[model samples]
Target: MILFQLSHAAEPIQVDDGYTVSKRFEKYRKLDTTISLPKLSFTEGQLVEFDLRYAQVGQRELHLDLFHAVPNKPSKGLIIFIHGGGWRAGNKSHFYPLANLLAQQGYNVALPEYRLSIAALYPAAVDDIEQATQWLLNHSSELGISTSPLIIGGGSSGGHLATLIGFKNNKQAHLLTDKPIPLYNAVINLDGLLDVTSELALKFENRKGNDSALAKWLGGRYETIPDLWHQVSPVNYINEDAPELLIISSGQARFTAGKDKTKRLFNENGRTITIIEHENIIHTFWLFEPYLTNLAADIAEFLMDVSKIEQE
Candidate 1:
């Protein structure tokens, strides 16, 4: 197995964002003994490419990790998986295991790192992801993948970003380029909020005053920036043009606010929306074993189904 590391001096100390693998494991282990942190190991046929710079925001260079097979053969399409840290924490490495597993299953996986709330605000991460999707699309041929069924997906905050990118398909004012935003064929949201302006979402996000992660990411509380709150909510963008959706929930209703409305909108447009619910599981269940494996398998199945439908 070959490994490429991101070229950087001594890694900086990670901030206490209250979102980390070790912390999530510690908190969830008591609830379910079957859960285990996924061990990172590359299969013989896997190709892992690390730290490919996709875009630059001033002095900060954004990078992505690509995972696929040795002699790559496109299966469904390329999947760009974003990491969730409430828009403030989490890194691309958080999705490494899932990307690896998905790559081994005959799909090209790109895990991109965007500017966090600490470095930038609201639309920064969204623009970064939009650029990342365009980067993958521009290099799809050389990378040995088809962009016909390109999929956007992520967990928690990442999931919200993915859904927003898929639904909002418009250039943001913060984007550095005038290029059209890349459109996705489907979305795989893993326990991400559909509506940030929901009563439940506001209850939790505004509970800590302006110190909440959501408030920091959005630049203010719902009361202060009601327009921004609604602007970022994926639920508000649902329409006939929206792509197919697969929502995998961890039985947390707060994270799934507006999910019913989203489903109804999709149904009204005759669009496909598949929902897989895992009761009694933690919010970050996609990062661990058992749940991780199941999540990957479900994603694979969804991709295959979407591909078949597209072909027909």
Candidate 2:
């Protein structure tokens, strides 16, 4: 077992937000420092390949946890799933259960670990996601994955990065230069905030307290680094060529600015925009029981229809 010691930054900056970097790390550490192990065994001929490094950030290596369909069956496409922790904390390991379900349905899913805000700032995680996808594409043949189409999805803050990565090439590269990104067949968002330009995000709230995730991830408030905020939001990059979207939310757009633009653009372009909302449930409710099974099915059906991927 590779022990990843995730600790708080020594005297870490708290910015205007009340929560200090050290505190965020502390909260995550209490949750667990490693990936959650698979509690349930697979019986549907599913296969899981663990711990393949897809990229590296300085000395800290980034890896992916993979799930595949029936052995030897070529998958319709590969999915790169990101986990959410308000951009501060989360692990790819917590996703094995869901990955198993998708694998059993015949889709190859890759859960990639990206640099968290505690480790790096805004675009570092973004760049890492791009790198992970490129690495998977590079090794697709050997891994029995097809490159014609790819799916990217995540919940909460993870959903933000997933959607941000799909914007036009060079739109978000940390190096300010982007390599070619694959044409995504679909984009999935589970209550991700797509716009950071809102006055509510940029101004209204105090520079402290629980709403510190975004400011922390961006290195400062939106007013201080407006460009960074603009770059990280996916809503600004919408176009007629954008892929179909599967938006699962309990009303995330109403809170995040520019999200309406995303919905509007998809509708204007005649793209297949499927939104499934569960009323009276909390945000990120799909993560809990009584909602997981139905959510999983919704994802499967959406990917299959859009990508022509099949369930075995």
Candidate 3:
């Protein structure tokens, strides 16, 4: 049986704890600190923030944290963020630091948590994310965000989920909304896997042991459920409609395979896929700053460039 193990294990990894920096980011730290309730207050024409329960009534409770930065000039665009923990563990709250930083830079951000595979399964997690995007679309007027050119991104497994949402046209029945969810304008995938079947098949042959990362995520050996592996892989569903995709990988063993699969998809579809190669960052280290700073700035610049065509 596939069992999920905490990658970080016992102690949580400390990231951007402020004290480690050469110069403390006093104001940014205060603004980015994870808090029970965000303390910033702004006028209507300025940045606004809130959380919304986007899941269906009487269903599992899911809350999405949103950050809106009203542009001094007409707004640029809105972006949604998904957190990655191999679809087992991760809280949207702890990831607020990323959202805060982006919001401060004039892009509205939404961070949502889906029911993990351990709690649910295949389409359930995808459904939760799709619903969050749908809810954002419905509330665009109230939230002060435009529906066009909405960008979606995340690191690691979140990157996988973001790509699935961006590439899959016929979303399965589970992620039901009254209407189709608005497709993403662009996607930022940070070290996310694309094809589980090929990856697992290779890993299994290598006898790398049950230490298979995705096997743990799927709750069993990939060999047992070959069909499920193909079904969930984003590479299987890519087509011309797949949004512009930006992939970043640290050239790790697990990630290189995914990058190859993604490149193959892009080649077959005649789409331009950009990859921001990193020096030696690990799976999800793109979420940390300094190391993340260059990528974040690139992302911010990319989104702004995309927004120029749609800006108010």
Candidate 4:
């Protein structure tokens, strides 16, 4: 409850770890209990199983939770979801609602936790994500999957990482490549910041602590780490070979600058870009159940359409 209050503050603040993974609600766990991914009112029989584990077994190892709606049956597809907490905070469990909704659509969903700013910084999170993706691809068969059209998406900072994975497969790329973290079929950006440089470059920005979040998350000032910033920006690597993208963002003042960066990516690769503008919604509205119904429906339709094309 305290963390929730901190999250809704008008401006961002450095929050204490009042609720970490081990301290969060036990009901969020999959052991000794069952989770029913209840069907959306418009959809039916879409409940999934909760499976959790560390992608690697050690400290700072990635924690991955796979949502499987079907038992003993192979999944038609998979969606890897990353959650955003300004890069410093956030967790995978908070994403169960979104993951469960996706699982109901007959697609297995993987929600993985990367190292955060509170413990580590920039590429550390990226590196962890790479490992998580590789684990998914390497175990695809065991997970009942058989395709290359893996879709990646996330909210805010997580969206930034998801887009980074989609745009470039570089030195750190091996993290997702026990055997090549197959090229994504589509990429979803949920109100994410595509370019940190642009956000910092904004004129008279009211979000006073914008760069603080980056420095805290990336571990250095932009001027001192230009290359690192560029290497991490998904918008900087946009090209013809990028995956199909569906970007959802709010029209609120807080996210306008980041939206501009997303706009540039859309313009560069106009063919595969799908932008959904949410009126009056703030950043990360998808976290709550109120907007999840529509958000899930849209995501389901997009994934289904993409899957159909892959089959063809």
Scored by TM-score, the top model is: 1
Candidate 3 lands at a TM-score of 0.75
Candidate 1 pairs with clashing backbones: none
The per-residue C-alpha lDDT of model 1 at residue 6 equals 35
The residue-level lDDT of candidate 2 at 225 comes to 72
lDDT of 4 by residue, 83-145 (tens): 877787787876777787767666778888777777566677877887777787777787655
**What does candidate 1's lDDT look like per residue over 85-140, in tens digits?**
88988889999999888878877889999988876888999889988888988887
Residue 174 alpha-carbon offset, candidate 3, angstroms: 18
Worst 10 residues of 4 by lDDT: 29-38
Sort by lDDT, top down from the best = 1, 2, 4, 3
Collision count for each candidate, in order: 0, 5, 2, 2
Residue 117 lDDT (model 3): 56
What lDDT score goes with residue 6 in model 4?
A: 30
Return whichever of 1 and 2 wins on lDDT: 1
Worst ten-residue run, lDDT, model 1?
1-10
State each model's C-alpha RMSD to the native. 4.6, 6.8, 8.3, 8.6
Better of 1 and 4 by lDDT: 1
What's the distance in Å from true for residue 305, model 2? Answer: 2.3
